[model samples]
Target: METMRVIDKIRQLIPPLSPGYHKGQAGRVCVIGGSDEYTGAPYFSSFSALKLGADMAFVVCQPTAAVAIKSYTPGIN
Candidate 1:
């Protein structure tokens, strides 16, 4: 029940998608956490944002992590 309430609250906060809305008008998400030893978290964070209707997602990470994250998908910048 608590989860349902949280979901409802989030729903209320998100604007309804409209045909007239341009790309990125909905939302943009940036995830800033990654290291050579741990790149999955940041990649997942950015990917989740895109999956959840964000128009764009960016990941900031260590150079070594950047390559791994980039290999996951071209969707994230």
Candidate 2:
């Protein structure tokens, strides 16, 4: 299956919360794919996870990538 189809299926599987539900009760995800030469990958992954409704997301990367990713945005760290 394609990526979009997979994402759609996941969305379908996730049930909506009740009216009184609070934050951080849904899901948390960490994007762990960055290296000295690849900081944007983690940024994109983390942002995409957030866009997909994850309550929290984090980017784990090598030192060089961490520096660049931090420079990209404080939120990325």
Top candidate (lDDT):
1
The TM-scores, one per candidate, come to 0.83, 0.68
Compare the candidates by TM-score and give the number of the best one.
Answer: 1
Off by over 4 Å in 1: 74-77
Instruction: Report the C-alpha lDDT of model 1 over 1-77, residue by residue, as the tens digit.
Output: 99999999999999998989888899998899998889899988888888899998888778988988898876545
- How many steric overlaps are in each model, in order? 0, 0
Can you give the lDDT of residue 27 in candidate 1?
A: 96
lDDT of each: 0.87, 0.78
TM-score (C-alpha, index-matched) for candidate 2: 0.68
Which portions of model 2 show Cα errors greater than 4 Å? Answer: 1-10, 17-23
